[model samples]
Target: MASKVCVFTGSRSDFDRLYWICLEIQKTEGLELQLIAGNMHLSPEYGLTINAIRETGLHVDAEVDMLVSSATSVGTAKTVGLGTLSLAETFNRLQPDIILVLGDRFELLSVASACTCMTIPMAHIGGGQTTEGAMDEQIRHMVTKASHLHFVANEMFGQRLKNMGEEVWRVFITGSPSIDSLMRTPKITTEDLSKELGLDLARPTALVAYHPATLDPLNLEAHTNQFIEALSQFEGQLVLTYPNGDPGSEYIIKSFQKLDAAHGDRSVLIPTLGITRFVSALLHVDFMIGNSSSALIEAPTFNLPAVNVGDRQKGRLASSNVISCAQDSASILRAMQEAMALGKSPCGKPYGDGKASPSIVSALKSTLEKRTRQQLLTKKFSIPGEDK
Candidate 1:
């Protein structure tokens, strides 16, 4: 019998990262692929990416409707609650041998919690990493403890899992599966992107992809406006990608759209771009100004300079090519100026060498065929006289 593995993708961001791993699972004999689409995937506002997955010639085993309609943390929490409730039913029906989840989105946490209750062993990716500005830090670690197999992006993350008392044998340092998309797919050329989007490739360009810091929403508009003001002063073309489905995302999207409409030939705003086009655009651009992790991890491989503004991505890895700045007009502009002048930072290779998918698949096949959960869940206690 094939070992059944169910993967959850709630947003375009996570889907892009998990695409290669899902393909790997599908190709493995005796490994059944189940995709559960929820949250933003169902939302028409964020491109309704479920169809995109189907377009790839893959089957979606289950569809869970769990996006809370409102735009607040309370609404996000409600979405999590609903995801858990719906996923319980889905899992009960599928009875998957393993549940695969990636990253630290609130929706991923709900799936992890539900799987924990059902005693379905979870294989988690991208844990043992930190993004202190967002609440993802808490959700990521919570899922880490509940997981049976961990595929972290780097050695540091694997060590962190060990420090947390997780069995070293259960953790695998597989780097990031996201980079696999770059390796497998053909690179998009500047001419192709320009023709597709009617963007002028000759102009000095700024590619912006930003998201809200869930921890602090008070200065959302203020910070957004500051970045806009700085970008407005630039004498070049600008392309902006909409933010993720967080509380303050709507405001960011509106601001970008407004700027595009007002700035006519100089600026273009897209709600979302496909992976190939996005990565290609990143390569063709002069500088990336945003807090998106793609700027941190993927851009470096292209030798692109990234100006990461604000705290949304507080505690993540960045190459020397990346410049950090506050969410203020002067600070952002200063960083942008530096980014335009600085040379490409050598690829750190800290996140992995784009071989994450195979490593993950090999481990999963071995674990699933074993058909028995390892007794790696031992707890440590302070023994008497252990302290010197």
Candidate 2:
């Protein structure tokens, strides 16, 4: 009998990262794939990305709506609580043999907690990564503890997972599935992008995908204002995407809207670009300006220069193409200028070689086949410097 693999995607970004994995699981003969769409995907404010999932023809087995409209810390906590309750019911119905989750979104953490209580073994991806500027750092580690299987983007992450006492046999370095999307997804031409996005790609352009720094203690509006001021210094067209559904996202959205209004045709603010369009934008844009993880993970594949502003992505592994800058307008402008001047160059990406999906599928198949349910639920912490 086929092993039932249930995958949970809470946001469009998470879905993009998991797209190829879902496809691979669906094609594998001994694996039955079940997808649960929740969080930002169901939120009307987040571009209704569930439609994007539907358009892909991947059948969504369940829909979990647990996003709170409020964009505050309290609201985010409540949303997590609500998601836990809602997912508990969903899991009760599906009763999947194994659950797969990726990234460190709070909603994903909620699902992890529910899965832990239900004694459902979880396969976690993107564990052992560090994003110190937000609360995701702690959440990522917490999810790592709950997960039975760890699939990381790089060897360093795999090592970190081991340091956290995860059994060596269960942790695998599968690279990033996002890199697979970058290498395999059909490229959209510049002309096609011009027609679809109504922006002339012939001239210099920068793709900005800034997200709010959840750890910033002061006024997030001030930080966003500085970012917008810096972008105003750019000489060419700016294609800015909306922030994620974090606490300070609403403020960033308003700032982007204001910038878009003032800049007119020079700037375009899109709520979501999906994976293909985003990868295409990376190909054509002269430089990327933002603190988005994509700037570090996916932009390197295109040999694109990314001016990563602020500390949101401070501790993540980056290639030569990435230039870090402070949140202030002057610092961001200087970094952007440097990135624009540097232009594109040959670069070595630390992420995988565009073959993460198959390896992940193989690992899932073998792990599920060999490990019993009781073994999957039980974990023994491996102390550092001690032989397994």
Candidate 3:
């Protein structure tokens, strides 16, 4: 019988990050694919991105309701509780040989918890990455402890996982599968893309993808006003990607939409952009302004310049090609000017080889057979100066 591997994607953000791995698992012989969609993918508020997965010719194994529609932290906690219950039912029914989880989304915590209780080994990607501002920092480490196999985005991350006492042999530095899509993505002619969106291709363009700073107490409207005020000074077209479904997103989206409408040709609001279009836009745009992690990790690969504002993406991996600044209008404007100057400066891809999918699939096929699922299920703690 084929080994069943279940993969979980909670939102468009995480799915985009895991796109290549899902495709690779589908192509691997003797590996059955199961896609469990949940959270923002199921909500119209986030564009129902589960359809995007289906458009790729993949089937949804199970639809899990793991998101709290509200933005409060209390709502988030309740969502986790609900996710654990729903995911427990799903895993008990499927009983897959392994679970595939990516990144540090809270929904993933529930998945890992359910699979751990069912004695199913999980293979976690992006396990050791760090973005200090949000709850993801703690959640990523927790997932790493729960996972049996680790496919980290970079060597530094891989070593971080190993230092956490995970077996070295079980960890693979497979880079980031998300970067693989950039390699296969067809070039998108600016004229065609602009025609598709009815945008003027000749205008100087900036792509903005800011998200909420969980640590910031100011209202979303207040924060967005500063960014919008700064953008009003620019003489170019602005392509704004809506923020992730965090506490302050609704307000941010409202502010961005209102501003975009007022600016007319000067701005456009895009709910979401496909991987191809996003990377393509990065290639053609004069500069990127955002706090989205992609601006730091993926854009630099295309030699794209980014104007990263605020603490949402603070302490995350980035290239010198990115200019960081405070949230005020003057600071943001200065950063954008610098970013426009830096333009596309050649920088090493901070994530990994575009071959991450193949390496990850190879590791799973070879390592799964030899791994001790029972040993993985049994949690052991180490004392000082003691070796396992």
Candidate 4:
């Protein structure tokens, strides 16, 4: 019998990163792919991205509807509580051999918590990366401690897992699967993408894919206005995406709406653009303006210039393609100038070599063949000086 591997996705962001690995799991012999989508994917407020998953020729084994409609911190806390409740029941019914989850989203904590109580093994992708500016810093580490297997983008991240007591044998330095999706997917022609987006991309354009700094308690509106003001000064067409469903994203959305109303023809605002279209935009746009991980992880592959505003992605690895700036009109405008001048040059790839899917698949297959669930689930605490 094939090893049944279930992948959990909570939002379009993580789904995009997981897309290629899911494809690899499906095609490889002796492996079965199961998918569970919940939270923002089920919420129409976030573009109902579960449809995007289904449209990708992947099957959804289960759907967990657990997001609370409230937009406050308590709402986020409740979403996690509800996710754990629903996923606990889902696990009871599905009985997957192992679970796969990615990134630092709080929803993954819900998935990890359920798997831990059930004694199911988990393989966590994007482990060991840091985002000091957001609550993800804490959630990512929490999931890392719970996961049985680790697939990280770089050696630095791989080592961090070891420091956290994960045996070296369990942590695999398989570059980010996001790179695989970015490089392998066929390009959407600029004209077709422009038509789909209803924007004339033939002219100079910048893409804004920012998300809220979930840890930042103050200046949500002030920080948002700073970036909008800077973008308004840009001499090119602007494409803005709605923030992900984080606590203070409401502020970001309202600010974007005002900018849209003011800028009219010069700006195009979208709720969500699935992976393909988003990557296509990166391929053609002059530069990116945001703190989304894609700016640090995927844009480097395209040699794309990205202006990373504020602290949302403060400590993560970035390449020359990224111009880091403060969340102020003057600082953002200065970085935009630097971004425009860079103009699509070669950027370093700190994430991986754009072929992480096969390595991850091979690791999963090897672990499945050689290790039992009990063996995989057994923990080994490494005292750095003592382990060696």
Report the lDDT tens digits of candidate 2 across residue range 1-388: 9999999999989898889999999999999999999999998898999999999999999999899989888989999999999999999999899999998888987888899999999999898889999888889999999999999988999999988899988999989898998888888899999878888999889999988788984758888889999888778899989999899898889989999999978988899988888889999989998889988999999899999888989898999999998889999989988998889998878988899999999999999999999998899999678965
Q: Listing every candidate in turn, what is its Cα RMSD in Å to the true structure after a full C-alpha superposition?
A: 2.4, 1.0, 2.0, 1.3
Per-residue lDDT of 1-388 in model 4, one digit per residue for the tens? 9999999999988888788889889999999999999999999888998999989889898999999977778999999999999999998898899999988988997999899999999999998888988999999999999999999999999988888888988999999988888888788999998998878999888999877888886877688888888888887888899988888888888888888898878788899977778889999888999878889998999999999998989889999999999999999989888988888888789899888989998999999999998999998887457736
* Candidate that beats the other on lDDT, 2 or 3, i.e. the better one: 2
**Per-candidate TM vs. native?**
0.95, 0.98, 0.94, 0.97
Tens digits of per-residue lDDT for model 1, 8-46: 889888888888888899889988888888888888888
TM-score of 3: 0.94
Clashes of each: 0, 0, 0, 0
Residue pairs in steric clash, candidate 4? none
For candidate 1, what is the TM-score?
A: 0.95
| Candidate 4 RMSD to the correct structure | 1.3
Q: How would you encode candidate 3's per-residue C-alpha lDDT over 80-122 as one tens digit per residue?
A: 8899999999988888889998888778889888877778889
Full-model lDDT, candidate 1 = 0.83
Question: Residue 261 CA error for candidate 2 (Å)?
Answer: 0.5
* Candidate 3: 10-residue stretch with minimal lDDT: 376-385
What is candidate 3's local distance difference test score?
0.81
Best by TM-score: 2
